[model samples]
Target chain A: SQKIEQNSEALNIQEGKTATLTCNYTNYSPAYLQWYRQDPGRGPVFLLLIRENEKEKRKERLKVTFDTTLKQSLFHITASQPADSATYLCAYNAGNMFTFGGGTRLMVKP
Target chain B: NAGVTQTPKFRVLKTGQSMTLLCAQDMNHEYMYWYRQDPGMGLRLIHYSVGEGTTAKGEVPDGYNVSRLKKQNFLLGLESAAPSQTSVYFCASRSQGTGELFFGEGSRLTVL
Candidate 1:
């Protein structure tokens, strides 16, 4: 079965450091991958989208890297702040549909 | 600009009741989608439309129906709501062939 996996556990990191999250998938080849940030009791807000051909993408302090060879993607938030704390979801295209993995919650200490 | 909006920002329904959630977008997007978000489940596509009047099933389409009669509006209807269907529903849209998605604030639904 093709499955999308992300860190089910919460991550706690220092405010000034970069926080890295991982997303892994099996048995599927997606054309593109996306990262979204969702706060409690709210819909996800789009962060970045990286095509399979692209190795990495960045927006301000957020960076997303896609590695089709390894069937994985990494999302990094540099200079993490308490305001940057949120659940990050990684999604991939699946036959015209988008599949999202269970998000990784990051809590940056103030 | 109201990029995307969902009617009935919040609702509480009894099991077996029926309701429709309306999503409207001003972005003139060609594709629209509906999804449900639950704890430990992230977001699951319930239904989507590639364009006006063209609806399609998604990963978890069961127990949900959709309509896109107009270019800028999509509706999600629940024939019979259930406790298991209680979730925060989101509406999103993007341009044709573009992988980017813009999302609405969301509709919080509770079933008793």
Candidate 2:
């Protein structure tokens, strides 16, 4: 019965700036959270993942922060480029199954 | 490595027709999943397999049935397709560590 929520609106930002996206959930407490990027006509590609016990995780230009108390996860893309423009999704495991958020489309303008 | 592959990238079926989507993984993963993506609903789990010969229902299994005769393949069957069932389907596989799920390109289906 986990319900994951993300900003359905598209995010527009200029180049060289940071883009931040949010993911929230209710009714279930997941042990870990994950982020993925999906281009048009393709399935989501994995980004970063953070655990409930961990405050943050990072991979190159991508960073993910998890707040268990807030039941939220924040994904940040530093120095975002046009190539990074895609729908970013946040997911959490409900037991062995994965539940995903609605997703936030990040449009990085050059 | 052809992590995950789904058959028939696109398809069109009449209402009340039936179809089966095939998914295969080469990663030797123990878990395989099927999901549907809608405009604003995100990805909803339809069915999943824990291992060879074992399948389980997920968040939205209605109107769909799944079979896993082998550990490497998962099949999702729609008994009677409806317009509402027209959504992009994705297949994914992962191991026990809960690492990022490896996904297929997705199958686009339309029911007229």
lDDT of 2 by residue, B20-87 (tens): 99999999999999999999889999999989999999989999999999889999999999999999
Weakest lDDT window of 10 consecutive positions for candidate 1 chain A: A90-99
The CA lDDT of each predicted structure is: 0.91, 0.93
In model 1, how large is the Cα lDDT of residue A84? 92
> What is candidate 2's lDDT per residue for A7-56, written digit by digit as tens?
99999999999999999999666999999999999999988879889999
Fnat of candidates, each listed:
0.81, 0.92
lDDT for model 2: 0.93
lDDT of 1 by residue, B20-112 (tens): 999999989988999998877888899999889999998898899999999899999999999999999999997565677888999999999
Candidate 1 lDDT tens digits, A31-79: 8888989988777888898988899999999889988889999999999
Q: What is the DockQ of candidate 1?
A: 0.80
Best by lDDT: 2
Q: Is the docking of candidate 2 incorrect, acceptable, medium or high quality?
A: high
Give DockQ: model 2: 0.92
Q: Each model: TM-score of chain B? A: 0.96, 0.97
